[model samples]
Target: MNQAVRSEPGPVRQTRFSFGNPPRGSVAVVDTIEGIECCSEAIEDLAENAVHPNPFYEPWCFLPLLGASDRKRRLRLLLVHGTNDDGSGAHDTLIGFFPFEQKLLHPLCPVHCLCPWRDSYRWTLRRTPLLRSGAVANALATLGRWLVAERHAPKILVLDDLPGGSGIIDGVERWRAEDRRLCHVPDMHESHLYRRQTDAEAYFSRVLSGKRRRHLKRLRRLLEDLGPVRVADVDESEDIDRLLNEFIALESSQWKGKIGTSMASMPNGSEIAKAILKEAHRRKRLSLLTLRVGDRLVAARSAFLAHPGCFGFKMAYDEDPVYARCGPGFLLDQEGIVRLHDDGDLLGKDIEWLDSCAVEAAALPLSMRTEPLPLHRYVVAVRGGVSEIVSRRFHRVMQALPWRIRRMSAF
Candidate 1:
């Protein structure tokens, strides 16, 4: 495992409240981002065993995001506590964790857009032990209260990129059902990337035309003949530095570098990626695949491993498009996918799903697993007024508009 990364000391604001039916436990509001900033192992433990596992929730990804955000944005963490029946509140266990950005609320403006700093809206709750019945729903109630009462965000909270039948979704629905006049609409969109069955070789063979498969095979052979070709998966702390350098250099050679968006082109982007990779490495949630000829890296991919799934974080290939014509990136993907299906990782975690975290109309052939991923923009008003009427009308109009226009308004 990589050496643990630490966050700089900062003032953390906190408040506690007892919650849940039959007194399951307390829910704490963490106004500052300090709670999970340095707790990689704790968050990893939750990711592995949470009621609904989201690989992106790993500390490696979110903490770096928290650090990278401009201080102008308000980041808060909601923590659910579980403990013994005694009301003393001693030895409380952390039963749930979710982070949120407090939106800028203008009193007269009902037409404001609801958007997160980054794509983080998952309410990750641990499975029941103390609260044996409906733990997920219970946790969401606490979180909902925190969002409205503490953070003072619009009652119409916009949650993004949630899978159907997720516990968080259930919890939100449950709250809406019980709470007075609480309404939510689930907006669905197709994320072109989803999970497929295990056999990589079989899937690849079935997807490609015979002639195209042959061409890829021939190109693979040609690339191999260049020198001693090898594919390596690095998870230990040792090889992360190599992965970072090779990936940045490879990606920089592409259009993203010229546009000043690639990691190599932006120093802040590079550091956040580095911190996330290193911390994820420590918790054994990172996988980096390198395709090399002799000692030269030809292609590389960085991914996060967790919760019976793998997420495609980033990818890069050789600078020369002559190599691109032959699809060196595809070659790396083929090798890496096969290896993952064979073993998953050193621990043999069943990597059931490969979440592309990508949009519709993508090129990669990720066989559909569940329903099309729906990116929802939920809005609920605190009370009926010009605010509620204007907010609903604006959101309805926005949703009815063309996809491009609606997307532009979201920013």
Candidate 2:
């Protein structure tokens, strides 16, 4: 616990919902305001509706949502509800969102999770007509104000928005003037988007070194010598079990993975994959991409349609050292991206990119998502003058160690 950090105001409150404000807790509680339970379902819907091929946030990214709210007593979540305009009526829709309180789980992470002051949690709000700007921002304010009285409060609040909309720029402007105690996270909502000429092509062009291109080109040309090659997308079918099993097999072989290898690295990973496929057909924007040379299927890619954007995942390519010269892995990826670009089903006006990396391909921009999903983390602190001083000294000493040793050392 850090003594320098203190509690701050929560979000704005609205009485119109007819829901009386729940009893405010003395300690921060980060619980779902809305859409937390259905996040994964929402991601699947987005993948099915993407007009252009781009990676959107996946629901699984919010796995921490399943955690207990009080675990991090100092952390709190503020979920702002967006309103949508529909012919039936205007209703609250889960729209653009960003996280409020964030704390680094492991201060020594070598990658994105490394920062000592990582307050930016997963936050999101719908980009479509599903949610309105004023309502969401007001709700966020209400939530912030509610946390003001807590004995232990979050030191920083992370806010994220795509460069353009989400009403975040304006929201931040309003949020700053209201409270000085709450600090904003730097580079909070800056997101990244990668582009290719076509959606069906492999997106790794950015990462493809000149030497890699030369080698890949020569390899492809050699593979072409074998015969005329072809690529295709898998059609929707009730045979999801068959398709998934085949996909897992193809993916494992392509990556030198086996029953006990990476594809099955985590029991939950395979379960999530299977669950996604089983529910794919039910979702309009969700689809999978696969590449084959005649009867031999060399690779497969899965993507979710997030209305204006799509999120691609689980890409695997079979590697037969015998055909190593062909570069089936690269070929499959290229074909998948190209196909996404060409697919008529994924075109729409409000086109946008979501998620930092859809495929995690070297070519992916490795940028943050345009909008941040509202996720929460709990923080606990020591109180009183002596406790505060000791806490500060302890935190400084703790953060000074190498990341690896710190992670393994534990709190």
Candidate 3:
């Protein structure tokens, strides 16, 4: 509702304004790394201020996805700009950047630009700075308005893997095209959250029950029987290259290797892995950890850190099935968590929490976690009034119908 209009000096003065978009504002789409690199300063600034930062959205990671995107489907890299009216003239400041793929409403449906598409992983959390110092809501509104103008607006825009307390949800609360959370525990989005407490014991107590603690201890003892096991943790950029290769090998040794889907297998997977890890390293946000039995690497955990919070991206183990019986993955996972806690601020960023980024079914080495990471799925419509009154009627009725009857009827 903050639609106050103000005057500007030059080309920006003629820029159209509506909804939360300011009068002196404009929008553009950037679908390439060259474009992103051009705005590196602004993009980096946004990353610094990003809420619940997701490295998947980083330029390097997206390089492959953009390349693999369907030619028929339009890839959108929406950039919102705010015009600053200095006495001399008007200048545009990069206020926001949103990336999404546009596709048909349905395979057979003639409608185009029904909404944005997400990948199979659902790593679509709010990585961009949704909570800017100011103009956050205005930036979103500008994007919304543009979607409407271009007929790219969906009746409902769904966002997957939204984290708890995300600013995106907060920003959309007041929009006529509102945001709503629909929680589901799909393996792709579900992850564990370990927040460090007083000490290791206390933290474990908070996350695990007495019985679970005993179980993990027994598993650790069995694993240690293999050999003298020790954890090596590093937040250093220099170690990422070697650590990355180790992780890929461990990951590929099992099903990932057989299926040729591991980071070391796919065409761009290695490049993406190297690029992201290297970038994360350069930004001083990389964490490479391993659990070794003598000189042999049994398990590896690598991630990208964002100050107090670290997001686990990959957890791989040497697959021998004997180690599986011994719980090698869990052992390393447990050590990695404790390493983050014990090392506390050694790197100047006190590890407060680790988003396990695990599938819900996988039992970690440390069964006792502070909390189950809440993963939320949500849908935001272009025009709330129209969606509620028109588009959602059929869905509402279908939902209301008896589940068994509907399934039997195949409706």
Candidate 4:
């Protein structure tokens, strides 16, 4: 079993550092939401021009979360800045944004560590830092150097759910090569990713086995027998508020509600969902698909658009026996994938792929219709101290635990 942290730890001490002989860039640590808000404009700029897009990290979604978090006081924001154009000594250009939370290694012990900031809601899937285009290597190097230089810094740094082929892993590897004191240990797993090939018909034919195709067809037929079935996609003219409410209701009527895991059931869960959806809608980066039978909404799925890629966020379906037998969830997923592949005007022509964002076990069915993309969690140890050795040993023990236990211990 994992050690439970009862008392909250103190905030990360704020610090600033300027890198390079002539000072090429600098890193500033902000430990409060208010402090982070002061840099909102720069943060948004960095997000817009980031080498990789992570809608989860965008200010619209992130700020509200930080405001609602119970551990907001323990959160830290690392802002990396580059020198301005006027050749003045001022560092105005925001090159990177990395958010972290300070936590105790164990409740009984005082050893502290830093992990990527995540809400207790567990809604976000990606944790990659926002790095400006053409400055990824410098940003990563500056971050590494700052961490190493901190006198009271935590020995362990944990970054979870970093997608594969995002260039971050390579950058980390190079940083480690340059400094042998940082022990980099990574754990990898695969998630489902859908990349459009030919047309929807041809693509599905190639990915779906004959048996599975027939089974799905049978399910669709069964669903239609109840009432006239139709698929709908949320459009620019649609009422987002009503649709979002319907989604929450439809989702809450199933097992999630009984288990208190549904948005409507959890504390502030519905409000958070609405806020995220609204933000995405306002930015014209939201995609919602629903399946209906004779006016009754059977299933719905939502995704956030980060141009060139989409991240599947959530999905829900009616579980009443009458509709459950028809597999409305799977049907809706098929329809969504079909539309995503065929309807260019709907998701925009720039969209290239969709990440299922489902865990390995939950992604098995999706894997049949999509490619596997590896995702990783990196646990790093900053050497040269007894605390570092303790952190390394702690991780070694944790790694020896069973997968289920390890997952439960993850925070």
Sort by lDDT, best first. Answer: 4, 1, 3, 2
lDDT of 4 by residue, 1-85 (tens): 1111221233334457877777666778877766777777888888888877888888888888777788535776888887432
Kindly give the number of clashing pairs for every candidate.
2, 69, 3, 0
Tell me each candidate's TM-score: 0.78, 0.57, 0.76, 0.90
Model 2 alpha-carbon miss at residue 207, Å: 9.8
State, as a TM-score between 0 and 1, how close model 3 is to the true structure. 0.76
All models: lDDT? Answer: 0.58, 0.42, 0.57, 0.77
Candidate 1's C-alpha runs over 4 A off are: 1-10, 19-26, 35-45, 82-93, 104-134, 145-153, 192-198, 205-212, 235-238, 344-348, 365-377, 380-383, 386-391, 399-411
Worst 10 residues of 2 by lDDT: 110-119
Candidate 4 error regions (>4 Å): 1-14, 71-73, 83-91, 106-110, 363-368, 402-411
List clashing residue pairs in candidate 3.
Answer: 157-380, 207-369, 330-365
Choose 1 or 2, whichever is better by lDDT: 1
Best-performing candidate as measured by TM-score? 4
Which one wins by TM-score: 2 or 3?
3
* Candidate 1 C-alpha lDDT tens digits along 1-411: 012223447665556766555556566555556755644565566555676565555565666666656666666555566643243333265656655555533333434433443532111211111121235565555545544453344455555555555565666677778765444555566553334445666656655667877777887987877788888777554667767876788788887688876776664666666777777778777778888888878888777765566666777788675566667777776666566557645423576666666557755534322335544345545445544565556656765778866654532
User: Cα RMSD (Å) per model?
Assistant: 6.6, 9.8, 7.0, 5.6
